[model samples]
Target: MGKKRVIQQTEEELIQETTEIEQKLQGDVKVAKSGLREGRIYIKSTYNNTIMTLTDDKGNTIAWVSAGKIGFKGTKKGTPFAASKVAEALSAAIEKVKVSKVMIYVQGVGTGRDTALRTLAAKNIDIIGIKDITPIRHGGCRPPKVRRV
Candidate 1:
């Protein structure tokens, strides 16, 4: 029988690999810095679900929450109640950053749209302004062909 092959890792190599993995895990946990006052909250609502992202003035994402992220599944994730819950959770996260005021940009036409905003207001987060930025098309695409006889 051939001699068994054995691969051994040195102590330095083992420590280096473990440190790399620890750094990667630390990167996954976001730590907010102090003095983040005003920011933007973008709400994208659809028939299926609602997503909320909180970002800084320069558009760096600070925190985000969605209906699906809150353990809601399927059609229930699109409901107003789910949206409100998502907002509630996201507000708690943003509060840790000491966000005093916010400008909200709402996009899409969904039942959860108003509910999410109401939840944020209930948290007393000082909504500075709300804007509906839903896009309107100019009708550029051609019409579909008629059905065959």
Candidate 2:
């Protein structure tokens, strides 16, 4: 029986790797604004998670935040409180872009949906419109057979 040996890096190679990483990090530090005004907010709230995305009027996404993205874990990510935090974080990004009004398109039957909208309002962002895009069951999909006893 023998133990396997691991590969070791030379000092120069290690220095090169570190410098590359630093350069990549610096490249990612740009400001958020892209010279746009009015935008749309898309909210998808599910039983287990809430995701909010901000996009320009042309539907190009500018920024996004989710309950899980804001550090909520497991079941807590679906709560209204977590949703509010996600909205708050996103509002700051939106404000930086000077977006005064937003047309919110919300799709879901989750508890966080309304709370997120309220948080945005409290942040002083104008609510141009709120549209519910939740899909309705028009007798969707065939149901599975009843379970046998």
Candidate 3:
């Protein structure tokens, strides 16, 4: 291994980067304010990770967060705790954008779904409704093949 190297950004570059980030954030807030106070939140909890997405009523995505992106590693990302944390962070983003009412659609067959929903409910935002959108096999899988002779 070699010595650690640090990349430095000039003052103007740093300022530009900050401005770009702020502009993006401003764009989110504007979308939230576009004649609809209600936003949609989709929480997908898979066995490996939990992901939450915030979208406008027209299905345009405003932002999204995931458990792994929150610094949890390996199997921990699938834990209920990580899901709740993801929910917490998403709720904060909702608050930032002043989304007063949220309609939640939860999917996936993971342990984090319920906990994440509970965490979102515990927040100050007003929940319009909660719906489970996970798909189910209508009549279960096809019967197994006949046992070998």
Native-structure RMSD, model 3:
8.5
lDDT of each: 0.82, 0.80, 0.82
Clash totals, every prediction: 0, 0, 0
Instruction: Report the Cα lDDT for residue 58, model 2.
Output: 78
TM-score: which candidate is best? 1
Regions more than 4 Å wrong, model 3: 1-36, 140-144
Higher-TM-score candidate of 1 and 3? 1
- The candidate, 1 or 2, that scores higher on lDDT is 1
- In angstroms, the error of model 1 at 79 is 0.5
| Higher-lDDT candidate of 2 and 3 | 3
Judge candidate 1 at residue 106 and give its lDDT.
98
| TM-score for each candidate, following the candidate numbering | 0.75, 0.74, 0.73
- Residue 89, candidate 3: alpha-carbon lDDT: 73
Tens digits of per-residue lDDT for model 3 on 23-129?
Answer: 44333322234345889999999999999998988988877888776666689789998898788778768877778899999999998999999999999989989
Regions more than 4 Å wrong, model 1: 1-32
Candidate 2's TM-score reads 0.74
Model 1: per-residue lDDT, tens digit, 1-149? 99998989899987885565334323322435547989999999999999999899998888887877666668988999888877877787777788899999999999999999998988979889999999988996899999998
Write candidate 2's Cα lDDT for 43-81 as tens digits: 999999999998888777788878766666689889998
lDDT of 3 at 62: 78
